[model samples]
Target: MIFKYRKGDELIEQTVVKPYDSVFGGQFDSWNVGKKLSNLTTCSNFFVDIISPSSPDDAPPLATLHFPVYTDQNAHCHVDYLRQFFKIADFCTSGDACKEKIWSTSYPDPKSDIFVGYDEDTQTLI
Candidate 1:
């Protein structure tokens, strides 16, 4: 999963290599589906919960990402906020024993490296 933030006028993008099983429940599917929207000029934002994606007994859990776009502006805002929160937690906490695995986004794959659009309506990534 790729998360974006605003860095001045440019879009700063990051990638969550491991699936966020605890949050979003359907992360893998989201990422797969996102592959289509990844190249789009715009994307949508939605809510995501933060929790450990792996455990001692259940390590590297799988999840499918599902983003439901609402017509209501308030709902969009709320989900966007939650998504931002999850992005932060994932980046700062990802580790062998952590909940998420976020990275600086390496090259090779256009979806995550350059095309990086997943679910942000404004698309103001930085």
Candidate 2:
């Protein structure tokens, strides 16, 4: 989710990052699900874990980007911290990859170019 581009951790590339993000493992899922009111504020965690440069395949992640898995304002801070990395390992998208491809948001951000609020009413995401 974090990119080297100007946008920082907030990824805007819908194509380059879309097709390559997701996983389904019972073991991994349980551990990553996080705890309630614990350090793991989210019920579920989704992020790209970054490994050290020139490091081995099994090295722990140096940083990560939990861009889309925050429960509240506090978790938002954690997401931001992890989004400032320069390098990352494999993928971790939970279900983001299936979002836009399946359907679009009828109520997009007002600042976004694709905004389709209630006032528009003319077009629904399809």
Candidate 3:
């Protein structure tokens, strides 16, 4: 789904796909409908929430990425933020453990890599 936020207007655009389980509720077997008006751009600052039916006790975790259009430094900052947000430690120094196995195997000298770290006490990504 896509939503755009705009100035002055309070509504936002929203699109939903069918044949998928509804996160809110109700058995929507057919294509449902809804609408709103807003001025937000395609790529703008916004918040998103994703939920699952199985666990209802806690709010779902969220990941956000912000990229500036005109600066390489900003781009690098976003990348590094993502790396740190995912709790990846020392991607530059780590060897095979930091590389994505599927990507490394599929591509010829792929430039990007991924790493995952966990908090032992909570068994969650830190």
Ranking by TM-score: 3, 2, 1
Q: What global local distance difference test value does model 2 have?
A: 0.41
TM-score of predicted model 3?
0.25
| Model 2 Cα lDDT, one tens digit per residue, 1-126 | 222111234332321122233473222212232353245443343445544345666665566555444445456555454665335544435456534342434333435654454544655542
What are the per-residue Cα lDDT tens digits for candidate 1 across 6-108?
Answer: 2233433334546656865656422233343334333354333222424443343333233443333345355564665456433443334332333433213
Tell me the tens digit of each residue's lDDT in model 3 across 24-68: 665432212222213222323333332233445464423222322
lDDT (C-alpha) at residue 71 in model 2:
49
Evaluation by lDDT, superior candidate among 1 and 2: 2
Clashes of 1: 18
RMSD of each: 21.3, 16.5, 15.8
At residue 108, give the lDDT of candidate 3.
38
Q: Which one wins by TM-score: 1 or 2?
A: 2
Q: Candidate 1: minimum summed lDDT over ten consecutive residues — where?
A: 99-108
Q: Rate the local accuracy (lDDT) of all candidates.
A: 0.40, 0.41, 0.36
Backbone-clash count (model 3): 5
On the 0 to 100 scale, the lDDT of residue 125 in model 2 is 41
Which candidate should be chosen as best, given TM-score against the real structure?
3
